[model samples]
Target chain A: MIAVMSGSFLQRGEPAIMDKFHRTKAALSSGVDIVLELPYIYAVQNSDLFAQGAVQTLHEIGVSSLCFGSESGDISRFTSSYNVLQQEQPAYQTVLQKNLNLGLSFPEASRHAYQQIGLATSEMDLTKPNNILGFSYVKAILDHNLSIKPLTITRIKSAYHDQAITGSIASATSIRKDLLSKGHISETAVDALPDVTIQQLHTYKKQAGIWHSWEDYFQLIHYRVMTMTKEELAAIHGVDEGLENRIKKTARSATSFYEWINKIKTKRYTWTRLQRIFAHILTSTAKADLQPFINAKTVPYVRLLGMTKTGQSYLNDRKKDMDVPLISTLAGTKNPLLSIEEKASHAYYSIIPGEKKQTLHHQELKPPIII
Target chain B: MIAVMSGSFLQRGEPAIMDKFHRTKAALSSGVDIVLELPYIYAVQNSDLFAQGAVQTLHEIGVSSLCFGSESGDISRFTSSYNVLQQEQPAYQTVLQKNLNLGLSFPEASRHAYQQIGLATSEMDLTKPNNILGFSYVKAILDHNLSIKPLTITRIKSAYHDQAITGSIASATSIRKDLLSKGHISETAVDALPDVTIQQLHTYKKQAGIWHSWEDYFQLIHYRVMTMTKEELAAIHGVDEGLENRIKKTARSATSFYEWINKIKTKRYTWTRLQRIFAHILTSTAKADLQPFINAKTVPYVRLLGMTKTGQSYLNDRKKDMDVPLISTLAGTKNPLLSIEEKASHAYYSIIPGEKKQTLHHQELKPPIII
Candidate 1:
């Protein structure tokens, strides 16, 4: 079966452990047929927009069903909540706005709004990270009226935010924590990851010499925030409600990335929300840069990152009917979204050393992987 | 006599060995009376502007004589060259423009223009750093018709660009290099500095925990250039003639600040010119921000960094007759130049640790130092 995943080259303002090339190779080796890059504009955002971009891209590529891992693995629960929330849109929005104005974060505000609208039931706990994202996926499909069906798989062994590698199946957060703490894949983390994934991780570490993390980017973020004027910071996407002042002030004394975030975090702005804002600042992604794509019917292009033999056959058969062009190389493309992607790629690799940086950066101009 | 040093708070895009407060205190202790800060807008600029700012500020402060160290050690040489250059302005401009168009750096082009105009006499070799600055100082006095008399002292023991500490009388460059290499005041460098200056350096290092250098700022500069769009960079002061593109490109793979500058440098862009451009980028000093002050008859305000008891008496007697306001505290000040200075101060202290950064930054708002 074809596997679709967000090519999170940069996630929440931090570079991923494995860049797109290595990640795409891992996916292809792990029984994934086709791998399409979820545009950066979506991948680095909050859950709802991220879900919308993934679902729309998958729908355009003629996927029959989308399966996601969730704490509440019942597909009916998500569908039922989506139906109720859709029917009570005005009431839900009003409660959402009221809670937001009362200084609740977006996730908390939306959860409160859902409960007020009688959409939060015992069968579906929206507070869990996976369940929240699962709800978003279902909501995106139903709201957009896409024909693709939604499915769910029960998340096993560890919770989404769990920081320990407990068993053979562990959360990505836990695995990354384990890897970063020891500067390599620990024995516990290795047990949780696939063999192919382990190989890819080793290769990336050997090539890049270090795993990418928020610490690698703290100085850059501090520099950007420190140098940017308040008006300039306000122009970046997700910098609202006079948050730029707090960011600038906190950045003045913050010695680490986590310390800065803890200082800036409030009930009105969750850690995740602040991370999204920082991501926008790091990439210089202004509101104007994202305005056109924010409400687009579908992403302008579907970037093909890699494919297996079977995946190649699937694309070969369906190429003529695909609604959007499949971008394999960035050489002559002129899309604004792609331009932002190119910039994001540069920023992602900017921390790498000289020869390795150029080699990895040149990957953006190369053709997609075919195995 | 009043001391009107260029402050060198940031010299050639690098922070000074001692911050302005310590430096001013050192000056006051070393027989200097009044200490006026050359405005940051001009202090961090090219030699011509730096000289103009200092000459005009000293003239405004009613200083009767300006003594500068020079390689030639002859005041008439500077005056004669200035006169000849002034009379041959049109021919010099033509040759300067032609050399600049042929990809010569500003200093090289101007030097060539001087030679073509017969102003590069054997009496004053314009190629010498001290001589160049001396010429600019004389030019500024003549160009503005300031009444302050210009004098020169022979530079002793070390040249302007000397990197090794050799004798008691050494260049500031050599002393700084020696101090930075050993992470403290070495005996060689100690010999070159006064007891008060050495004490101040020790205290600054103890309080700030580090000596500031271009290496300390390389990461921030690299980050700024990497994330900024070409247009945004082009808007910064000194980023001209498509240098933004080269800066952005070079920053992609540059491992260090010096390496990046080296790669971006050519016959057309000298190292010092590049440093000034980088200083502008670091401070976010836009051309528009400096446009009003560039050609003004005198600085809008003379900031007093520090003074001695005698200096206080002198200021008290002359305060009422001064043409420009003397700013001892930044509180309630609304000048654009002051705002830029405030931003620059923040950028300067941004690398220090938490409590120290706040303490050092607060110095910007405090009353001038008195010794």
Candidate 2:
């Protein structure tokens, strides 16, 4: 199943929310063999974007068998909305905007359009945003002519927005919220979480690293857009000609990243579409420069973050065939910026209270913890 | 005469000797009004190389004259050496190497080559390296069919290698030795120096802004070479195609920068030549890349380190048809790098130290003292 997941948005042009390499490693370690990197723009923008990037990467990768969790577990009802998005496609643009113009929030407008179309609203709980994202992923996979089959995982209580850690497996959202609020691995998350997840969180907190979120890159994003020449801005990953000048001029008046996006976003663009443009603009991410990288996915070297002897051997056996070199220690090298990202991740990981690393401002006391 | 002078050589693959922008400013501020930035590779290496860059830049810029200082005040002597270099140069190739193989120093080897040519022993005085450089510049201007003429300023008392400052304006060698000895500008230099010069040097020192020479970037240079693929290394600044693998093999064995150059030097290639190759590799300098710049002579950047109001007004009048932009202030702009460079130059100017600047480091410090 090509399970579409929202990759963490890296705003502020810092490192990703979790270590990107670390996150990829996490998914790889979890037996989820192929984790697609969701462009940060799609992750930060509203639901429409979640669909666009998730669907596009999936389409490009030729992924099939799309899967997601749904509040409405029943098979027939969910299909009705899915079918409406696929087959009986009324003008989604007109319907969605008409609802929004009537003072509905974007999510409400989407739901209202679904209900008015005689889609089986009774059987589908289109209220939660995550489910809507799940729905969009399904509809987009179908629309793109990809041969992906959709699968559903039924919900087991603890609402999508729930911050409480009730069971052994806590929601990622709650875990992240709790981790940030407590400023280290929370005892609740550490205690309730499965063993593998705990080690990942603990290693990242207190000593080795910090996390960056899209919410923080507001200034950097705004400034980058404002400064770039229109021609240069047009080269941004998602930006097109003429739109760049609009973005550049609008960027100056933007109060924040979101404000800039709002000013630049247009009828042809969804917020997610616009967010991707902003992300690219902020990072100077020219598609011409980076497209080759998209096709050429493997990094030249695999840096060892943390590994058991078994993991080490697993890597050693595979290293011979691997196209890239693997780097473990930086005892002799001259790269200065390399270690800083890991150190920051460790700082963020430490925020969950009562973990081995409970310290704040992690950079001050970073000494690599040797296994 | 419009004498063309090449600044420090930036040998590719090697660590940078001096920052080009800073050196250019220092030269210009020290009455070098029409500064030429001979690509770093050419400037750092020995005489033949110094000529290649300086001559090329002069030819391209359409400059008519070249001024180089010589201990042997007779300019014709340098011209004769120039003529000798362009001839079927045999004694220079072998005799020079024979001296080097005998463990003789740079001066001894240089003298050996000249003496073999039946030149007067005193005429071949190799202690004055600048004279050799001047000789090469003249040779190259003629060889390249460039319009530029060559001129010489007689050496003023202080010999190029003299450990002691024998005059008001000591040779850069003595100045550096004195700085190293005391870790600050010397009292002798302070009293003898022009006021404007002292002001900038003090600014640099106070700012804790390191005046990083070739030494500081040694690690960066090493890491850059080590990290690159064979093809990438070959494509680097100075590396020729086959030279890529040779460098890669050497990189695996060489421990230090000098060691690498020594390992690579051959009968055909001198240490200075190797140094330039290294510089090219590190800085991503290539003959093709540099050739265009050399042909362009100088970019139309006035790049004022510090200018009087009269200079500004004169520029204002001159700028109407000026091809380049007249940048006065960075103005919270993206071009802060250029401003940072200007501020950095404040450290190299050596007179009226306190008046020049109290510091020239972090953004917290004051900007360069605008004249």
Candidate 3:
């Protein structure tokens, strides 16, 4: 079966350890037959848009099912939650606004809204990170009236935000922390990651000379905010409510990326939301750039990052039915979304040292992996 | 008599070793009566504009004479060169265009134009940095029909671009290089600087924790160019002729500010010109921001950075005759040029560590120094 996943090309303004090529290769080596890159604009956004873009891309490519890991593994419960939210739309939105006006973060406000609408139950907890994402996926599928069925596997061994690696099946956060701190994948992290993932991590570290982290980009972001005027910062995507002034002021004294974020954070703005804003700033992604694609019925194109022999056959069988362009090589493609992806790719690899930087950057132009 | 010198507030994109307050104090202590800041937009620019802005500000404040150091110390030679250029305007323009089209930098092309028009003489070598600026000052005085007389002192002991400190009268470049490298005023640098200047330098380093250098800003400029699209960069002041593409491409592989400049340098673009462009980029000074002041007969205002007792009396006597405002404090001041200066000041002090950063940045709002 084809496997669709959100690649961490850049996750919340931080570059991922494994680049697109290596990650695709790892997935194909594992059991995944096909790998399609979720466009960067969607991949680096909040959960609702992220799920919508993924669901829409899958529907366009004629996928029949979508499976995700979540705290609530039962599929019917997610559907019930989605239905309850749909039935109580007015009340839900009103409660959401009230909680938000009371200075709650979006996630916290949404959870409050859900509880206020009586959707909280012992069998289903939507507060978990994976469950929240799964709920978004189910909502997107139902809202778009796509013919894809939702599936889930219970997440185990570690919590979604877990910072310490446990038995096996550790959260990505813990694994990244372990690998970055040790300068290589430690024994505990190796236990959690598949063999292919471990190999990819090793290869990426050796070739890139550094693992991508928030600190790697601290100087860049600080310069951006420090140099930008209030109006310019306001023009960036997700910089609202005079937040530009705060960012500009905090950037002057912030010694590190974490410190800057903490200084700017308040009860209303969550860390994740702030990270997304910073991601947009680093990418130079303006609000105008995302305006057209915010509610796009379908993504303009589906980029195939890699494919196995079986995945190639599946594409060959379904090529005619696909309506949108499937881009593999970026030599001359001109879609706006694809252009943003290319720019983001350049930014992602801009910090790599020596000749390896140019080599990795030029990877944007090469054809996708076929194994 | 009031002493006027170009403050190294930020010279060609590098932060001055001494900030405005300390430099003003140094000038006051070393027998200068008044220190008026040449607006940052003009200070960090090329020679013609720098001279124009300084001459204009001095004229606005009713200064009777402008004195500058030059290899060609005789002021009459500058006047003769200016006269020849004025008489041979058409021919000079043609030869300058031809040399530029033949891929020569502006300064080199202008020198060739001078020779081609038989304006270059053994008595006055326009190729020298001080002579070039002296010529510009003479031209500005004549062109604007201002009442200021131009004077010159023969520069000795060190060339304009000297990188080593020697003797009592060393170039500012050499002193900066020495101090930055040694992390203090070396005995050699001390000899070049006056006792007051040495005291200020030590105080600045003690409080600021580090001396400012181009390397300190390499990361910032690198990040700015890396994240900015070609279109966005082209909009910055002095980024033209598709140089944005070169800058964007070179930023990817460049490891430091000097390396990036060297990589992007061509025969047609001089090192100084590139530094000016980078200064503009770092300050986020757009081409549109400078359009209003480019050919204006007078600057909007003259900022008083500091004054001694005699200087304060001079200002009191001349204040009534002044047409434009003499701004002492930034509180509630509203002018475009002042706004740009404020923004640039923030960028200049952004790299200072800890509470010192905010303290220095807030100096922009503080009243001018009176000693």
Best by DockQ: 1
lDDT of each residue in B4-83, candidate 3, tens digit only: 44443454556777678888889899888888888877788778888888888898899999899999899999998888
Q: How far off is residue A97 in model 3, in Å?
A: 3.8
Accuracy of chain B in candidate 2 (TM-score) = 0.61
Q: Which has the better DockQ: candidate 2, or candidate 3? A: 3
List the DockQ of the predictions in order. Answer: 0.42, 0.03, 0.38
Model 1 residue B112 lDDT score: 90
Residue-by-residue lDDT tens digits, candidate 3, A272-347: 7888888788878899999999899998988888898899999988888988988888888888787677667766
Worst 10 residues of 3 chain B by lDDT: B3-12
Give the per-residue lDDT digits (tens) of candidate 2, residues B1-371.
12233333332223222333344345446654444344343454556755775566445434457677887777777767667655737767788889887766455677767777755357655446666666667777777666766788888877766777766868766665565456667787676556655665665455534443444434334544544446556665556538787776665445466676777776545665566666555444445544443434433232333333444454456657555443433344344223323222322221112222222212212232233
TM-score of chain A of each: 0.96, 0.58, 0.97
Compared with the true structure, what per-residue lDDT tens digits does model 1 show for residues B1-371? 77765543554656676688888889899899888888778888778888888888888778888999999999988888877877899999999999989999888898898888876677778878889888889889888788889999999888998988879988888888888889978777778889999999888988998878877877567667766778889999999999998998777567778788999999988887788888888888898999998888888988888888888898888889889899998878888788788777767776676577777767877888888
Better of 2 and 3 by lDDT: 3
lDDT of each: 0.83, 0.51, 0.82
Worst 10 residues of 1 chain B by lDDT: B5-14
Q: Tell me the interface RMSD of every candidate, in Å.
A: 2.9, 15.4, 3.3
